[model samples]
Target: MNLYPINAGNFKLDGGAMFGVVPKSLWQRTNPADANNMIDIAARCLLIEYGNRLILIDTGMGDKQSDKFFGYYYLWGNDTIDKSLKKYGFHRHDITDVFMTHLHFDHCGGSIQWNKDRTGYEPAFKNARFWSNKDHWKWATQPNKREKASFLKENILPMEESGQLNFTGLPELDVLKNSALGFDIFFANGHTDKQMIPMINYNGKTICFMADLLPTAGHLPIPFVMGYDTRPLLTLDEKEKFLQMAVNNNYYLFLEHDAHNEIITVKNTEKGVRLQEVFNCNEVFNLI
Candidate 1:
């Protein structure tokens, strides 16, 4: 199996919102903000080449939203899924599985796109089976008021409408041993309901798609939760357990939202689980 970091693009999010209750004095050290107080963010999607299946995890937000809508999140990079795939000598049509970590627009928006002629939407990966768990599918489709905006209909419904959507079934547990994607899945609900984190074993090491469970190296502090989380207290607990496990196993965390830090490892310090080392994508994955 081969792994590639498919950078969808870079954008900005409010530093305050990204770091939750943590004061800027702390967060700014790792994620400095612009004059407008927005911090750099990346939609660093992951692509896996496993035998005959090319799997993509968590597509960045697509370009279909209006300029006015995108004005909120200041976009800042030239990277796109098409461009990223081309870099690795692949294409969207080559993807056999599009596994979503969650249904938030930024995480799954690129799964669907405006069809030819722009009359309506359709699955972007014509040959891919879009993957989302049953609980998350239901929660995203019938989203709560707090998360309604993040779960955009245009970014989601078309996968099902196009008959490419598939639900992954796993028994109730914190970790599902061998999921439909041929990797273990860590179920996290603190950020969003039933968000799946993939634990991929490659070359005698484990690479975890950290998603929002551990967004960046700066989020190592247990209390450093996002304002977007539905239940901050629940996030605190989930993070504590997850970080401890990460430190114990020495998993290579492949960050999806951290613009600067592509991957990191954690160590149990006197304070708590702290950033052990930071690595670029090429250093860890040996890009195709």
Candidate 2:
């Protein structure tokens, strides 16, 4: 199997929101914020090439939102999913599967796009099957007060309307093997209900797509949960278990939102799990 890091786009989010109650003075050591108190965020999606299938892990926030909507995120950089795919001799239409970690706008927004005349929204990848768990599909469609804004209707629904939406079978425990996307999924709910973390076996290493579970290396600490999480306390427990497993199994964490560090490993330190080392896609998987 081959893997590539597809940078859909880059933007900034409030540091406090990203790091939760963690003081700026502390988080700034790793994730330095701008004067606006915003930290760099990457809509870093992963592309998997297996057999004849070209599976895109998640599409970044698509370019369908209005200018005013994008102004809030402070988007930067010239990267787009099409450009990133083309860099590796692929295109958006080549994607056969789109496995979203969750239904958040930033994660799945790129899955849908505006039609030619801008009359209605449609699936961005016409030939791909969109994958999200049944539970998350419901939660996102019937969003709660806390996540209503993050789960935009335009970013979703279109997949189902496109008649390409498929629900992966939920695992009774921590891991769901042989998912529709052909990878094990680690189910996490602290950030959102049934957030699927893809665990891909690549080049003799377990590469875990760390969605919001550990957005960046700075989030290695257990208490550094995001303020956006619906259940911060639940996140604490989930992180404790997942981090311990990562250390024990030596999983290569593929960070989706960390702008600085692309891939990293965690080791058990005196203080708890901490960043072991940072690696490039070339050094780790020889993506090029």
Candidate 3:
């Protein structure tokens, strides 16, 4: 099996929102804000190549939204899914599975695209089976007022319309049973209901996909949860449990939204679980 970090692009978000109630004096040290106070964020996806399957963990926000709509997010950079795939000599059609961590626009927007005629939408990965759990599918489709803005219909419904949508059977105690992807999925609800975090066993190491649960190394502190999370208190409990597990198991965290850091490991310290080391995808896996 081979794993590659696919950088879709970078965008800007309010640092305050990203850091939640964490004081700017603390988070700014790790993620400095611009004059407008927006911090740089990467729509970093993961590519897993194993046997006949080429699975993509998440697709960054696609280029289908109107300029006015995109202007709010401050999208930047030339990196795209197409360019990233080409870098590895792969194409969208080569993907056999598109595993979404959640249905947020930045996480799943690339799942669909405008058709050639621009009359309607179509699945972006024509050959891949789009995966989302039953509960998340319902939650996103019937979005709550708070999360409605993040779960856009265009980024979601087309996958089902194209007849490639599939749901992972509800897991017992958040452990995905009988997964075809060769990873154990841990369900996290603090960020959003039934958000799946894939625990990948690679070359004698376990890599955890930190999808908004840990966002960046700076979020290692227990209270540093994002404002976007629906339940901040629940997030604290989840983080405590997960961080302890990460430290105990020596799990390498694959950060999806951290622009500068690709992968990180944590160590139990006096303060709490703290960042141990940061490495690129190849740097960590290649050594193993």
Off by over 4 Å in 1: none
lDDT of each: 0.92, 0.93, 0.92
Instruction: Count residue pairs with overlapping backbones in model 3.
Output: 0
For each candidate, C-alpha RMSD in Å?
0.9, 0.7, 1.2
What tens digits encode model 2's per-residue C-alpha lDDT throughout 8-69? 99999999999999998999999999999999999999999999999999898999999999
Error of 2 at 267 (Å): 0.6
Model 3 per-residue lDDT tens digits across residues 1-288: 889888888999999999999999999999999999999999999998888999999999989999998999898889999999999899999999999999999999989999999999999999999999999999999999999999999999989989999988778785785487888898889999999999988889998998989998888899999999998999999889998999999999999999999999999989999999999987976724
**Candidate that scores best on lDDT:** 2
TM-score of each: 0.98, 0.99, 0.98
How would you encode candidate 1's per-residue C-alpha lDDT over 1-288 as one tens digit per residue?
Answer: 999999998899999999899999999999999999999999999999999999999999998999998899999979999999999899999999999999999999989889899999988899999999999999999999999999999998888888889998865769988887899999988999999999999998899999998877789899999999998899899889988898899999999999989999989989999999999989888752
Question: Per-residue lDDT for 21 in model 3?
Answer: 94
The residue-level lDDT of candidate 2 at 210 comes to: 93
